[model samples]
Target: MNRRFPFDIARQEFGRASRGNVAVIFALAALPLLVGVGVAIDYAKSANVRTHLQSTLDAAVLAGARESSPSAQIAKAQSFFDAQRPEQFSAKTSASFSVADHVLNGTAQAEVPTSIMAMFGRETLDVSAKAAAASSSGGKVCILLVDQSRSQTLLANSGAKLIAPDCEIHVRTNVSPGAIINAGVNLDVKRTCVKASTVINNGGSVGNLEKSCDAISDPYAGKMPSVSIPGASCKSENYNPDVSTVVLPAGNYCNVNFSNQTSVTLNPGMYGGMNFNQARTVKLNPGLYIVKGGNWNVNSGMTFTGTGVTIYYADNSIIQFNGNVNVQLSAPTSGSYDDILFYEAPGLSQSNWVINGTSSSTLRGLIYLPSKAVTINSVSNVSADKATMVFASLILNNTNWTITPGNKAMASSSGGAVRLLY
Candidate 1:
């Protein structure tokens, strides 16, 4: 059976069918495009927040590791994180700090808020950072200057040559060019670490120079013994002996003056002021010599020798060696002041310690003056074979000075350093 329809009626039916198919195809394609755009925007927001979180955490951990106190470290970490966090996102920051066996460890964590990613049900991003620091325990330090002010805390000039091959020199000056070697001066050492704002080298050679180093704290600050002046002087007035050889016993003296061709031998004891002027020979026995509220002066031609001894200076005291002199000193091998040749009292007035001589000198111990400046000028040969440590506020070398390391074991066993771990 053949059933025919009108042309207008068939055209209308085809047009309606095509319109429905076109609508369905357009709806299917538009959905995926919208989804892709939304995902990209949400992921970009997450990535931005994650980057900020990681940077803040890293800074927080570093701050925490620098603090020596355990309680303070945690507090510092939190504060640093809060300060470094970006204001665009709300982040919950937390950190932990711990120290064991001189090693400091820090960990920081942050939960950063997400913005456009909320559509995907991801509302937060986790970021973390860790840091570690250590206080070094081994290594010999030949020189340490602990002054925070002063552009030239350590200076070598006038053709001075300092050779320290087995140790490091640490300078803690906050001024520009904290340590310098002037023209015609040569400094040869294993390492020179400075905490100065700037470093300057004029015409000298230094091996392994490190600028902006960490400050070194005193290791024996609290361990020094207290000293009290005697109520009544055991011996008073000046002692100018006419004889060639004289032996002085240990006691409390008001003022000790030796001059004019006198050969003096000092027994182990306390002295108020020991002054030697134009003396031929001076000897010190094995013990401690405490000088209080006076000046220890050795001028002109003098020969000095002391073995197994330690010299302690009280407040407002000065030690000077002028003119040509021969000195050989060694610290005690055992006791409280073991391996300590010279020690200055804490909280004393800031002054200058001068050591100048024309002849060779041998010192085998530590010379510690935490609050004073030490100047060494025009010495021929200075040898510290049994380990020697010079710790002062400032150290200046003028003219020629030669330093040789004889023994590394003479350095203090308690000596160590603190540093941040990157």
Candidate 2:
């Protein structure tokens, strides 16, 4: 030790001291950076837990809102929440619900624990969410499809436009290859929903789509007028339309054809479905017109008009109306089938029903075809005071339909919508 010089000893001591100071300075600087990183990681984990709770809370709120009683609602909400609890962060959650003014309101809170932020004394983060829902009326399904297993239940072909400001367009086929809202078709309505999970919108302006919805059952099923076909003795014989005017009584008939510019009037009763090839003018008075087995077709050269009428297709073959002239029709009010214009029998053959009319047509009321593929073609628009079309399937080809909802019964409600507040 005594062999070393005094300058050498001093240099060795300075080097050791400098190294110790540098390490101290580095530890001090890295502490803040480590804490910042830990906060970010823990905050992201808490946010992910909150997101999971939010989606689960939405489902719980909807389940509670659909219940009838307050106790039942709470039970349903609790059951659904338990069944669909998010398995994120082992969170502790609590939910509460209340119904006021026909609206179901829900609030939920979660204690989502942080992982890395625990070192900085942040043990848990508080998260909250809210939701509201209500029920709608039963008579608001306007353009509805009944099949729930078909590949393609409804299609809006090229050049098809539908503007229904207050109507409900519900397609209920839940199978794959579902409804196609193709290109060149414009659909603007109040509410448009498809039950299928595979709804394709190809460059067309369809509804703000909410797919995979619950299928809606037909409202008018098992609820229609009783059918009683008239006997041959009480039936009207063959109608020969070589005259200028003919007033038809309420009776049954078979294979009647109207031609030769004949003017006709119809009273309400059972009758065989007929064809209108060429007619000057045809009027249907106010009552129920039961149509038995036969076809109801109107060619291009027919001028037909009806108001305050209900045509019940008991067992008709087909209903195709080609419109080149004036064709006006409506449904009855203050009756059993108040808003029903054409009611196809549920037991009828699964055929096709084509309904097209002129732009001056006043075709209104509910056209219920539960066992038929309904088509609307060659028409420009369907402006009506009140109309509801329920089909097995629907097709629109090169036409436009302006479905106006003048009936308060056909108006939409807030039940179909569930909203999250915060």
Candidate 3:
């Protein structure tokens, strides 16, 4: 011990002291780490609560927007959050709604109490959500066809227009064109076709026409027309164009308004009746209307045009014609003639119609001259507008014919064409 031990004792003692100091230093470093782990666990719980609050709020807002009733929408939104989820997170929700014009708006809010963030003074986390959703007032149809055969009334509204390109025409009582007659009860024309009407044989004996016209008074509540025809009687009755016009019936039915005009295309169908109730006004642009009906009668006061207008009747639409022809309505152009044509039905024993045009008239479609007759009524201020067409034919079989001047009177497809598709 005196020789070797004396040389190493202090050094060995110092080495042991150093190892112990190193262990103490490591323990001190781990203390901060443990605290940090504890804080991270608390932060995670707070973050999850905030996220849950956000999701619940979003769901509630969407649900409120989809509700049709105000109270129900709000109740459903609150109930949804109150429902327990697998996450078992508790949330408080509030909702509100507003409706303006056709638009609806809704908002929702959700709050969740923080579990660990309270240590940092963030007592609760809040989230907000909102959502919005809209319906229109009009019918859109590019083409409307009217069958005038059995229909004795027509009422025209403002949105409807017409295109009839040909001649303004008139016919006499004895003359018959034998073409089918397509008419409307409340016929709507946006342009101008005042010259379109049935002319009686004797300006004195318009009993049948007066009766029919009288039956269906103007749904528009406009001034009644004078019954210039002798035998015309003033019968007190109402002819309703649309079922909605049963009230406020017009008493005296005499004059019909032919200011605005419209057109309809008649395919090969046999339509017996149609009505155009004047819910609104109608304006007719320059266009053509093709019609094929069994019998034809226009309600009071409608604008019908001749520029782009043609009445194409099938066989049975026109029964007989007896009236004067007014020629002033026809356009002034070469190869133009206001016309009424007759022919045998495609598949029938005998033809059904007797159509007639008086002033510079030409006719097309089916016309029965044998059993049917067409007449052109006389109207003052006759205009001889020539009649021409891509297809023109006239058939007459023992049908009377007459002529006179001054025959009066008378889109893109997008819901089918205009729009942003996608």
Models, CA RMSD each: 13.2, 16.2, 22.3
Arranged by TM-score with the best first, the candidates are 2, 1, 3
Between 1 and 2, whose TM-score is larger? 2
How accurate locally, in lDDT, is each candidate? 0.68, 0.72, 0.31
Q: Stretches of candidate 2 above 4 Å error?
A: 1-139, 232-242, 406-422
Which of the numbered candidates is closest to the native, going by highest lDDT?
A: 2
Candidate 1 vs candidate 3: the lDDT winner is 1
What C-alpha root-mean-square deviation, in Å, does candidate 2 show against the real structure? Answer: 16.2
lDDT of candidate 1 at residue 53, scale 0 to 100: 62
Query: Which order, best to worst by lDDT?
Result: 2, 1, 3
Stronger candidate by TM-score (2 vs 3): 2
Candidate achieving the largest TM-score:
2
Candidate 2 overall Cα lDDT vs. reference? 0.72
The candidate with the higher TM-score, 1 or 3, is 1
lDDT of 2 by residue, 136-224 (tens): 43224567788776877888888989877656687878786568878898888766778888888788788656678654556567766
Error of 1 at 65 (Å): 17
Candidate 3: Cα lDDT at 354: 28
